[model samples]
Target: MFIKGVKILFVVLLFYLMTSTSTTPLEAYEETSPARRLHKAHALCTLNKSPPATDDNDNEQIVETFIRCMATKMGLWTDKDGYNAKQVAKFFNKHNYENEVMTIVDYCNHQHQQTNLDLWAYESYRCATEGRIGAWLEEYYMLSLKL
Candidate 1:
């Protein structure tokens, strides 16, 4: 009975945490100190350096690589770039349509009080590889600003 009660309590707590709408992403991020964020980023960067499994799409690997690249470019961490930030930036600039990348970068910077560097970097890579970054950025900008 005690074990069952504990399991039930755990499930309830998990549900509450998942369903709680009171905390925004920005607020949740702000609740952690900058040092903590840096530590987490460092750990993630280190852990994600290995290649993913053969069957996986490696989306998370891509995100992690982009995060590390952003950290390097921002001087938040000193690590070698397997994924080059300058090369990504050049690609983005070369392929961007009608300054949409500039607009998105500027808007994200204003919203984040920083460049939203990681997200922009990820989006740039996604755009280059997958196309339709402009539409995705527009939707993301609208939703994020609305929040």
Candidate 2:
């Protein structure tokens, strides 16, 4: 009887923790102190080492690679062309920001389709970073107040 009661209590506590909006201080710290966003850009672009190919497609490909790398780092992308729903949900859950942000990606693919590759790449990075930072800042501020 005691063992069963203990198991039930554990389940209840786990559910509460998973469903709670409040994040621990360590989680806030990890979210606020984001890793360098452009680490992949320099290694992939290597513009100083050699000029990129003259073809527009080649230049665009470089931009695509950079954008993809950034998205992957943010857990918004997968090895395949698009994002995996399960993985994205897991990311948002782990980060504890499902209630704060709306769209899965900050910018939609259709809106940038007509733009120049450079602009598209910049917008992608900008939007993702802004959304993440905004959420992190809010969570960090709230947690700090609690502390």
Candidate 3:
């Protein structure tokens, strides 16, 4: 009889342990979801400037859109119009910038620490506009990797 009582108590304790292991409300509230962070970043970006005027032949607008899309592809923005890595690679291939794009992808993917998304977005835009992405890719990789 005592052994059976112990077994029942053990089962009750186990059940209590399992059921009470859920996160506290404070913990749940403190942790921001990745999707929410992405949305906030996108909102901040949009609030910083007016939308660029659209023109089919406007090279500057085209490049700006491409950079912003790249930021989204890097998981830094919530914009629906952004390209993924594969699409960005295709774009680079079409523009004959495939090698530079490859370098950028490798650097961004393999860095030891997280890159500052805002700084990266800004630097990428600068490099894209200056037609010096290859150099910027190398520099960014070195700086980010501390190598």
Best candidate according to lDDT: 2
RMSD of 2: 18.0
Q: State candidate 2's TM-score.
A: 0.32
Model 2 alpha-carbon drift over 4 Å, by segment: 1-32, 37-51, 80-101, 104-147
lDDT of 3 by residue, 1-147 (tens): 344334333432332333244233223432354323333434454455445546533433433444454356345333332223444455335357766675665445433122444334433434332335444434433443442
Root-mean-square deviation of every model: 18.8, 18.0, 23.1
What are the Cα lDDT values of the candidates?
0.40, 0.42, 0.41
> TM-score of every model?
0.26, 0.32, 0.28
Return whichever of 1 and 2 wins on TM-score: 2
Tens digit per residue, CA lDDT, model 1, 54-101 = 532353444435454535533433332223334323324535543654
Question: Which runs of model 3 end up more than 4 angstroms from their true locations?
Answer: 1-70, 73-85, 96-100, 108-115, 124-147
Candidate 3 CA-lDDT value: 0.41
In candidate 1, which residue pairs clash? none
